[model samples]
Target: MSAVPISEHVALVTGGARGLGAHIVRAIAAHGGRVVINYRRSADAAHALADEIGDSALVFGADVTDKDAVGVMIDAAAEHFGAPVTTVVNNALPDYSFNGDGRSHADNLTWTELDAQLRGIVGGALNTIQAALPGMRAAGGGRMINIGTNLVQNPVVPYHDYTAAKAALLALTRTLSHDLGPDGITVNMVSGGLLRTTDASAATPDAVFDAIAAATPLRSVTTPAEFADAVLFFLSPWSRAVTGQNLVVDGGLVKN
Candidate 1:
């Protein structure tokens, strides 16, 4: 595809300090967009990545679960960057609640744990979208991409809370797309299976990884960069007509 002209557009990515979020930030910068890297606790890493990327990047520290904090982060990003944010990638997740440890099933999971997970995933997206919408509407157009999971479609290794939250996010994406379409805003989702060896997934066992890979049609695990590519597509003009869709980037692991 021909390069998308993202020059002068400001993009905000939650959880942009490392892993998949970092890759998404880099990809946007590579495509000539200015990026605001948002993180909750990885301030050092966030600043380092922003510094490494030079003036086109800035780091904002905010817990996505907190609406007020998220608004401040978004406002600060717009003030620091020349353009108001016209693109948003909701990739920030709470520390993983699911490992292969088998502790995340419905039986063991408490309502409090489930509520926390849902709030982080669903509430975060809503907060950021609310903060960014006015700027986008004023600018005449924008894109919102919410990161989700393939497990919601095929729950092979069940993490009830995480999957349920992501499923809610997908539903939110569709509803928001319809609600905001008339105002020149688009909402979409990108879902992926277990990515290999990111800091978040480091505790996952080798055998579990192998089993997922074996079951995937591609017979391999995906990388953070590969997942970032899908996010980039949603930001590009090619996907202008696509909204309220969940694009799965799991190497055909869950064919729906």
Candidate 2:
């Protein structure tokens, strides 16, 4: 298989208005890919980011969990770029916080909470995948990189609902890898530990980050930029032969 350059792909990044999703957008643009930045409510941030990237970026608003909305967004992206989105980064996250002290334990975790997360994480991915299928098929090949969590593996904090949803995403990623392989679509995941700073992790105390960094081989908590790099790898031609795998980007914190 011939390797394709990042410049050859039009990419869509869900929740690309801020945080790690924003970083992923920047990374893809920096590497010469055109980006469709999808956001649900962070319109200002999304517009600001698209402005920063100039012509290489397009800002689209849609709730990833809404299949019809996602379909419309994908259609708009194709019309805007004059090409289908060949790379998708499933980075949209539902409202979540990483403050362990405030997290609900498994005993107190409600089914409603788990269901919400499943809809946001798994359902969102499913919507985007289905919406983008026709475009990907027409484009010949594509990349689908799902954002995951290291908590699914270690569960040190045991964020039961969040971990459970991401675990299911990983399962979905593998299943899609098999089903989509014939179509030349590679499905993979990039899981990160508590990133140093993101809206989701903003509530995390400094002490927790310090403690995590101290325990890591790199002596640092992963940054949004560092984690974004892994997403880039999965999107790049270098990963043409790679799929159905999860790359953990947590400063060697969780070696599995």
Candidate 3:
């Protein structure tokens, strides 16, 4: 069994001011966990979320891609909550639009675009994991959940750069789970399909959403709150023995 209970966890959620990240933070806080809301440019939203969450939440602005900033944020969060952050939700993403027409064609995509996505996905996860390692080791156990996408499996839109980066993140999630298992830190991923209406998916046409819902077994697009509930499972004691796995929470849009 996991040593820590859900109530005792101090969770740090990157890009946790609005959208899916905010929902994840709300889920954690609702379960009695202290939450650290990390944001890069959404300070107002972050502060508002913290205010709404009250004492159980702390707001911090730090770009996850900046190693030093992430390190500092981890330390500060530990001090604020009197416990090191025991749960990390890597939910940040580079500025992206989901509109297929707006996306760069495969032939037109540049290495720069790909690199930028990789940095936000893989690079951010690397920074937070490394910064929180000692704390998780000391806490006896911890949970790490990386937000992923079902597009990695289907890739129906051919978002080459985005899907490629998330694929890399999945690889990192598995390898790190192996590397960190000895420390009692379980790493896993929760992949969702085009969320009903996250900031990134806001640009998606209504027709696209309708098509996705029609294809899914549930006959509906997964909402942010629904996907966040899956993340909560990874943080709970029931998932103590589950790690290095990716659970797709997309209304069965793409079965793994």
Candidate 4:
């Protein structure tokens, strides 16, 4: 696809080192926008991707749960990329934990596990959004897209913690939209079902993949690029009037 005309716009994507996050970074940069790729631990991978993207992309490291670090990351991005970060995508997760581990039964789940999940998905989003608000408001308009999951709608697997965290993120998206709407900031969500073969879903069993594909109306798994395209729509002018909504791009896996 040809690049979108996002020249001079700056975008910040958290957890942008690999998997779906990596696709987002490339997508934004390909569209001619400057991107701040945030990574917590994948320094090498982050730098490598940034290098591959050339000058439009820069990698920064920060623990998204740490407000101070998040602030620093945003500030640095603004200084380096001349932000009013017109776009922000929150796609980071704490760790890759599959619900199919068989150890995730309600009886085995712990507050500690739930807490960590919340911090990564919800807390991280709050931190990044809070940091970007000033610039977005100053710019007169912006887009904030949160990465969610279709599991909340039709959870074939019982990934209680992950789904719960994303549900909370959807709530945050609505609240932020109303809170920032008057300021011309739009907040929305792009939720997806089982995406194929990304690092995040690498642990999913072959049988699980087959079942998900069969269950989907499309009878196939979606790609990370396809999911990224949905996110791009939210960032584009076409979605300027769309906010506080969750757009599911899960190949008809969930009709709602």
Candidate 5:
């Protein structure tokens, strides 16, 4: 639980309709934080989550890659919540999978795939950050959390394009921290390994999970709910002076 109540702040989680984003949204609400659930297409799921979260949760559908839509989302969230959004969790993943069963090898990899990721992750992050900056600045501060992956540090799966984009996002996180800190805003990242079961990782083999668990200090795979909790720390007053840090939450699968 956060020592400082974020109940007055509106926290936005992009792609919050399902997967890890969904869990993150629920956790934010559970901690008494007002939340905005941004979804690209998962309309039904978004609405269901809003109903589950009651009045504290607001659902908005917008493609994160679109600058105009993202701006609209930020404005609507502030209007609906009667306050500027103070925390942003950039968790919207483009079309990518962690199955490892069918992936492009180094020789067969193409720039197109990499471009897609850059467009999705880096582009989306930029669009959202730019759109939300004014409100965050006027409010005197904010927190921006980019959902990263341990694969960049460990390279356990060689998810080339995805890893590359996240690495780029991490760089963005650090640079933004330097730029945004003076405004009393904090920027950081939360990195996780291949999660147990998300739509993207559902095709992953059991043997791989067992191998990961066998080597991890916790002796278990990291769950979405468990990972979601770590995100709150950055938004909490406890991290008042913290910025430009990457918190890895993969049950010790990758130590950095």
Candidate 6:
């Protein structure tokens, strides 16, 4: 089989406004990939990011969990770029804080909370995959990259709801990879440990960050930019033979 060069394709990043998602958008653009920045609420931030990234980025507002909305968004994205959206980064997330403060332990974890995460992780991903698959089929092939968490492996913090949802997403990612392989669509995930500082991790105390960094072999916490760049690898030709794989990027915290 031949390799698919990502730099020539249009990449759409859901929740590509701030934090890791935003970093992914910037990285793809920097490498000459056209980008579609999708956001559910961060409209202004999304637009500003597109402006900063110059013509390589375009902004769109759509709820990834909503299948119809996602289809419309995909249509608009393709129309705007004058080409099919051949790359998708399912990075949208529900409102969450990784501060370990006010986080529900198993005792207080509610089904409602898990549902929200599921909607964002699993449901959102399902919608995007369904909406974009046809375009990929028409365009010859494509790539799908899902954002995941290292907690699913380490479970350092018992963030029951969020962790559970990501675990489910991992399962879905593998299943989709199998089903989409024949169509030339590669499905995979990029899981990262506690990023140093995103809206979710902003409240995480310095002591926790320091402790994590000290424990990791790299002696430093992961950053959004670093993680984002790793996501780009899957979309690149280098990973044409890799699918149904979870590439964890937490500084070797969990050796595969």
The true-versus-predicted C-alpha distance at residue 106 of model 3, in Å, is 2.2
| Tens digits of lDDT, candidate 1, 53-133 | 999998888998888998888889889985678899999997764555755665677888779889999999999999999
Tens digits of per-residue lDDT for model 6, 38-145:
999999999999889998788889989889999999999899889889999999998887656668986877899999999888999999889888889998889999
- Indicate whether candidate 2 or candidate 6 has the larger TM-score: 2
Please give, for residues 97-191, the per-residue lDDT of candidate 3 as tens digits: 77677799967999999999999999999999999998989988799999998888898889988999999999999999999998899999999
Each candidate's TM vs. the true structure? 0.94, 0.97, 0.98, 0.94, 0.96, 0.97
> How does each model score on lDDT?
0.87, 0.92, 0.92, 0.86, 0.89, 0.89
Candidate 5 Cα deviation (angstroms), residue 1: 17
The residue ranges of model 3 lying beyond 4 angstroms of the native Cα positions read 1-3
C-alpha RMSD between model 3 and the true structure: 1.0
lDDT of 2 by residue, 122-220 (tens): 999999999999999998889999999899889898888889999999999999999999999999999998897988778778998999999999999
What is the descending lDDT order? 3, 2, 5, 6, 1, 4
Query: What is the C-alpha local distance difference test score of candidate 4?
Result: 0.86
Winner by TM-score between candidate 4 and candidate 2: 2
lDDT of 4 by residue, 78-138 (tens): 8887656778899999885564756477878788878888999999999999998889888
Q: Positional deviation of 171 in candidate 1, in angstroms?
A: 0.3
Whole-model lDDT, candidate 3? 0.92
> Poorest 10 consecutive residues of model 1 by lDDT?
1-10
